[model samples]
Target: MPNLPKKVRSKKLSSRVDLTAMVSVSFLLIIFFMVVGELSKGKAMALSLPEKYENGWHHWGCGSGSNERTITVLLDENNKIITYTGFLFNPRKAPKEINYGQNGIRKELFNQKKAILEYSTALGKPKNGPIVIIKPSKKSNFKNLVDILDEMAIINIETYAIVNEFTTEESQLLASK
Candidate 1:
């Protein structure tokens, strides 16, 4: 045997993992949370009952109710004005025709105003009434929402509301319970 020197041992080095995948996942999660947060902004408000008058008649005047007359405006999925009902001339009468075509929203709004005037005259009350009640679907478009608001302002409907829809089943359950 040749010269057998002292044996030397080499220490093994630990391997390092690349954190690229982890970084990517974290970024994706951040983006998802941000989007969700944005989507839920300004949707936490509560709904209150529309106001009723001293005589038990409710009028949504500028979002207040005082037992008078009211107009209910329903916005559909497309954000287009879908239905305008309640008090064409009196609170008891059915609403007039509602045409929701591309150019018909304004036309219908004018008609609503006319109907309001007629109703006020018939009832021997002041022509000025409370705000219109706007029931917009949750998924309504922002543009449509703005347009409706503008139209309400133009028509001098100072009071209004943005209400959520109610399912028939939900109503029935509540009624039963």
Candidate 2:
């Protein structure tokens, strides 16, 4: 009888995986993303346009009212802003280019507002601030419009309009610069 040789055998390991931790981690990640999405929100600004008259003219002026209390701002290309007080044909203050920011249009607005209030008081009329008329030409970009609107808001300007129409003289004025 021959003695049989003993064969070496390896032990079998378990194939089952623990999915509990993975499921918990995935839920935590989902909740974290949801919270972040809710926290981040977009901000916006509000704009109110004036009504048009049957005569193809817009009801203008604000605060104290009257045409002489109006400040016309013409936005042009190359970041140019031409400002004049009262009517274009016969202006109380002639048109001139002004910059943006605190020193430029902002400063002018403050001065104009103060002057209009004083003028109204002296005339024994309603003492109100100036009415700003904003005319942005086709050459101007959207950013210019937005920046000007922001400036108006920052200046606490209550009455302003975005007029699209431009006269021949306005175009010529824009071209002259």
lDDT of 2 at 126: 53
- Candidate 2, 124: how far from true, in Å? 3.1
Per residue, candidate 1 scores C-alpha lDDT tens digits across 82-142 of 4435432244334333435436766666666676666667677655554466655565567
The reply for model 2, stretches above 4 Å from the true place, is 1-65
Output the TM-score of candidate 2.
Answer: 0.64
lDDT of 2: 0.80
- Put down candidate 2 lDDT per residue, 68-164, tens digits, no spaces: 7788889988889999887677678999999988899999988988888788778887546677888898989999899899988888877777888
By summed lDDT, the worst window of 10 consecutive residues in model 2 runs over 55-64
